[model samples]
Target chain A: MKKTTQTPPSSGASKESQMLAMVNRRFFLRSAGIAATTGAFILGACKDHDLDPDMTVDLGSGDIGILNYAYALEQLEAAYYTQVIATPYAGMSAMEMSILTDIRDHEIIHREFFKAALGSSAIPGLEVNFSSVNFNDRASVLGVAKVFEDTGVSAYNGAGKLIADAGYLLLAGKIVSVEARHAAIIRDLLNPNSADFAGDDITDSNGLDLAKSPDMVLPAVAPFITTMISGNNLPK
Target chain B: MNIFKIIDEIQKVDGDAVDRLEYATRRSFLTKFSRNLSAAAVPAVMATIVNKAYAQSPAAIDVLNFALTLEYLEDEFYKMGNAASGLIPSMYQTVFRQIGKHEDQHVKFLAGALGAQAVAKPTFDFSAGGAFPNPFSNFDTFVFLSHAFEDTGVRAYKGQAGNLINDPALLEYALQIHSVEARHAAKARAILSEIRGNADIKPWITLNEGSPAQVYAGDDNTVQGGVDINGIAGKSKEAITEAFDEPLTKDEVLAIASLFIV
Candidate 1:
């Protein structure tokens, strides 16, 4: 369940140094004001479009909106999973440890995939601080885990329509099903009867539920993050 | 009289004609009075019209109606699947009951939202018009129906994501429900894999590889294909490997619903 450390590619390019440089540059940007703005301008050109100003957590345009919307959730999940691994929950069982580590790896992969796929259009890697979570308590950690995993699945389900690219949509389906798996495992671990699988909220008498837009999720996630992030420019 | 009473009496001085003239300068006093009388009677005449207009407006009521329908389908399927005792294992009864309860909760939640009664469950003919009949004769039936229901539930949630964006409370509620659906889908995939064995380890599971038949629902393009016997098509490696849910147009969802409703 340990994260597979990336070996330098056959070309011998060391990612460690490169990542260090990236971090240094990020620090430099945060401190060096007007002078750094020039480099930042160049970087911004290559940066993904920020969340759309109009992208409220509502569902209007399908596919693109959904993907950007999911980009946001992945951002949160990647952040959470990153912290959990950084600080292991106390009194963790061997099984919990293994599963959680695997989940972290999966979240990182998901986060990286979205970033790469989104490229210049993807959201900037968000800073997630889980100071409120008690890493020493199993209940606290699992409670947060349940909330996040559940939110991830629901976020994808709610944003499914806003995706435009068939390939991306397929990718989302693949990833979401995995998230669903994570949710079920966590649910079973939490309480036995909680796993409903294919119940009524999603499928209706007519077999349908609503997909929300970024406007809906941003405010909803406000309590979790320190800085405000936008979902406006996701997809028009 | 007190000073206030004196002021009141003076203020109440016959200003009715002046007020009438101020409101309608062009009208004779008699004509203005008559017009006021007519206008007063007009609201009573238009009350019926206003009520009719109000009745015709669609709200989240449409969303509730949609949920009501899907719940009926899900409820009936689980009930019927459980009833055919040979088709389901005794061990899995708890699973079915748990899922059934979720579906029932969903129905109650949606019905409560709509302030309406639950819709009666639909009679699903797993036999596709008897052309390629009931495929789930035993264990395969449960798997097929379970997978189909789970898959359909996931897609249906995707299909309806647009409808609940306005109300934050309901949006959160729907999201909570959606996560449960995803969990169900994953569990079903696991069960299907264990039951069928040699199941493809695709990222997403599908019923057919070369045909339009799917374990959940029809592909966007396949109009004709051999019907799957378990009421669901078998698994496809490519289906889940590269599978993502397709977002449907509002019109498209409406059309799909039309097939089930009278």
Candidate 2:
């Protein structure tokens, strides 16, 4: 779960901005070089974003659109877990700490994987608003974690049909189950020795977990981020 | 409300529409059966069209039947385990009961969806010809098998997502059930870890480490989408493997399931 890549094999062996460049690369570019070209675009958007916070970031069309949709969610998850680990809640057990730490790495890896796969088509790093989350309190942090993990599973489940490529469908399948596992572990932590791991609320009497459409999933996660994500171009 | 009237509307759009319906309806074509049918018959006739429209395609039917076979195994396995006195420890009975309930529902749901096409539940030898001599009698052995079944279910459902692609509704249902199995599997792994006092057996599969090693084949792979992602974002190799669950093809899954099938 330890996440530190002092140097990417591909990115330049440049000066002090390596740290800044790494973060920028994840949020803004496919590689360190692409950052220069997308740089102006990012700055203009930043000023426009400052003026109009409601301008939507459109998830493009076709498989790229679906990939971007997924990329966006991974960004949110990676950011959240990164924050959770950076500022651990009070009285966090060794077991809980380890579990959350693994989840954080998985999410970041997921985020980076999509970014790498999407290449230039990937959406920029989303601005998160975690004012609603209380990182110091275990209950509050876990509550948000539960919601995020469960929502992630539902989003992937629902988005399967929108994926036109068989490879992409299988890839989405690869990621969702891991999210479900993360969700189960977090739920177990909240209520030990209970069936809340596959609780009745997220799953139905038919025993199927929730499969929600992008429209349904987008709004649920909207509160967690300050940036607007317009899923209008996403495949139905 | 009126079959002929609806056909007339359709004919206005395309002169040969009724002929195509007569041919396209396949098993439910009504014109061949009753040429003098009245409007009252529209209700009955239209119902057949609606039903056939939702009927599973050949691909989906195969996947659903395969899924049904797996669900039947899980439902029966858990039922027997939960019913066995003093088999599941008092502390973990509730967890087993809940899992057993979900498997039961999965069986009924899948069988109901398949209806006449549903495959009969195979006679399962939980003992696997003495491979698992005391599946129900031994609590630890039972937990181990439980983990295997749940994990297999997740992989099995996932492998068939592409087959169900043409049928969106079926694909969605498969996904919904797939993740539920994952939830059950994670809990089972955690319980097994507790039973054996092994922290190495984490909720997520750590580099294909688990009993019934075949199920975890291809799991140690850090490559995804033809790219070596071991060091992506600087995460450890274990995290890379744990981040994604690999799918087992239908043939692969059935071979594993056949161990218990008589």
Candidate 3:
């Protein structure tokens, strides 16, 4: 059966209720005129900010760990894409420019999505040091692009099973699909003759896909990533 | 196309009129009419419903062992593959070396998770019953084995996802490694297919745009046309789309392990 419609909240009703709740006899007895002013002042402080401190930097655990894990990758991807867009490679094709731009947007969306979704559990905006990368050179950009995309795809594939919530799994799948597309495009850029773009990276003899735990992936990603990011709080 | 269709259907379910109706249009007459329409439609939809249960099997003792076994297989394959001096492209030598280390790490990690009390790691044959008797003899064997090994690892990881969900920590770590293995698999396929100018890396067992074991024969590029995954009720896809990998039963995985295990 279809569910009933949810009731919508009236604008500022909740705020008005709180303001009145502060007007008890204790307020009149405490400091008369100043109590009313103090109550209003306290209400003003309760307003929420765009950047919540509780969510800006997560310490890792359960869903927070996963969010932080995703947050770190988003930071890396966003930085790379930002560089790509800021300085397109020499002789960059329109298609390449357009696709890379779209990829950049997607990465930003993903980064922001994690931020919004995690709310109070999101990690702080990470500091990604990709200073060694030369964005103007096609080969250099593509090489790093290949590594980053491949790494992203691997990261997703390895983390899928750890999620118990199907909702989260579905979200991860959506992101992974996009990441795979990015990997394919990057691989194609590296070598048009290379069938690398349209291939499987982690399969086995009986035609099974390989998965690894974060404990394994972090050490590998650690060398490339200069900063030490913790995901210890991700659900065990 | 499938995704578009699904979204389209969802939009239809939400009804265009409902979206078009602004908050200001919540008058008595329109609200009553809409409410009646929804009430009428609900019963019709409810009457034909069949409650299908997608009952999932919990992680079996055997599936874990199966995963450990696959890990062993990949661990051995990479060790041997890396040992081949001229086999790897000079440009990709560093890539392969790093991949080898990653695979070793995966094996060790799984070994640790499984613990000493966990099932023993399977000993791989590395030979597919003389199908490719001398894999080390030539580049073709290397290519074939590499492709096969990587493909198998991808599926194996996918197959075990359900079983490991109960162990959140282990599952999380396993997923991290799974992604690395996928990269390795893709890399291996790219190298092999590029050498032959085939340009196609979709395995014979994968179908339905690489969903693996879900499409028709002519639809995919598999050499075998199509092969049903035992215990799993579907045909392998063209390249094994990253969508859903078939879950393997404990018995099914153990049976495969027995073939290679000493």
Candidate 4:
């Protein structure tokens, strides 16, 4: 079935240009020797609060911790998809573009939702390092997309119990299914008609999807994130 | 007079009501009645009560059994589809095989968890009483039913989350199953699109997908937590629908599953 060419409303806003500007500003700030000082100052401030300066950010405790945890992952996804659309993969079909753009918007909305919900407790904008990913190659991009989406679904699943608040659990449930949808699409794009959709690695013999705790998940995504996330205060 | 208070008052009045009668029986009756009352309306409140009802949360076990029943149906569906000769396309045989294995594993895992409490798998009629006959013999019929079953399974797992909330480990496990079911749903839809040459099919559920509307019911919802998601900047109904999947109630889920269960 051929998908329609309708793009999400924000697709027209030129997020790529904004992302480039942000990158350039970061470059300028670093070259001026101000970035380290700013980082040090933030660390010092955190120390005054009895927070560990060694860790980039502590996710806090209880429901707030869970929300921040979700926020951090959503930030990674939004950044990754934003980059994907910014530099479309070679030989990408219009259908691929449309669906991926939809996924991009969904992740951004999820990221923004957690940000809004957490308010002051939310972690700062996470800097991502996607140097390992080849954005121009469809296989490379889709392969990464599959990992992110599957990881995202499992992360949310694992964290559901950490959220004591029923409202937050419900919210997590809402988002994970969408992530699953993204996972399926990315798998299909990489190898259509392959069993990759419910691959044995991510899913167990019982057909249940894998669930990884923050301790397990944070390290897997660590390479892509420049900011060190400490799940120290999060619920065990 | 409050019925619960009256039950207490009866013990005070006769003083022998507790000694002479079976306390366990009376208490069980009260708990069941209260739960039934709660289940009548306001699902969010009912969910909280159900989850918190721990010593009473054998109710949770009941929920697990319900999940196992659905898993059994799905496992058999995929296994049968894979076994049917010349039914599934050559290109798609491996996909069905993998899905079938997962479903079989799901059945085993759930049954293992339930142990002696696990319910036996019921006989399933894939054709829904001749609604669509010879499903195993027709690839199109099989594909369409597969989509329905996968989607139903996703919702079925989601519907039970509230019931399992008191058990954090179990709740997380159920959530894990829920997402896999969703992945299965997406894959089935994608395959259907490929076979039909319909480019309009999306991996995610859209507002309008035509026929079998029950699958998409409540999916078009835009209002969540007293906020219209569409009211947010750069958001629309379509985007809102795509953002969050709606959960089916247990009754709603059973009604759908019953179509296949004899």
The model with the greatest TM-score is 2
Off by over 4 Å in 1: A1-72, A79-123, A127-147, A153-178, A189-236, B1-63, B84-87, B111-121, B129-137, B163-176, B199-244, B248-262
- Model 3 agreement with the true structure over A62-163: per-residue lDDT tens digits: 433664587678667766787788888898997578567656655654554454354444455554566777778889888888777766766776666545
lDDT of 2 by residue, B17-38 (tens): 3233223433323443355468
B27-53, model 3: which lDDT tens digit per residue?
Answer: 212332345467667555333221100
lDDT of 4 by residue, B59-170 (tens): 5566666777778888888888898998998998988888788788778766665555566677788888788798899998898888888887776777678776656656
Best by lDDT: 2
Q: Show where candidate 3 strays beyond 4 Å.
A: A1-88, A91-164, A170-236, B1-64, B83-95, B121-123, B202-262
Which DockQ values do the candidates obtain, in the order shown? 0.11, 0.37, 0.04, 0.28
| TM-score of model 3's chain A | 0.69
Give the CA lDDT, 0 to 100, for residue A138 in model 3.
87
Backbone N/Cα/C clashes per model: 48, 0, 68, 9
A93: Cα error in model 3, Å: 9.2
Q: For residues B1-262, what per-residue lDDT tens digits would candidate 1 score against the true structure?
A: 1223222222332323233322221222233234445777755634433332223213334444555566666766676666775666766666776676677767766654443222344445554345324534567656655665666556665555445433323333445465466566666655665577734522134333311133334432221111111201121223222223334443444334333333
Give one digit per residue, the lDDT tens place, for model 1 in A75-153.
Answer: 6776676567668777777656755755654565455444434444444444456778897787787778877776676
Candidate 2 lDDT score at position B126: 92
DockQ of predicted candidate 4? 0.28
Candidate 1 vs candidate 2, DockQ winner: 2
True contacts kept of 4: 0.62
The global C-alpha lDDT for each of the candidates, from Candidate 1 onward, is: 0.49, 0.78, 0.49, 0.71
- Candidate 4 at residue B254, lDDT? 69
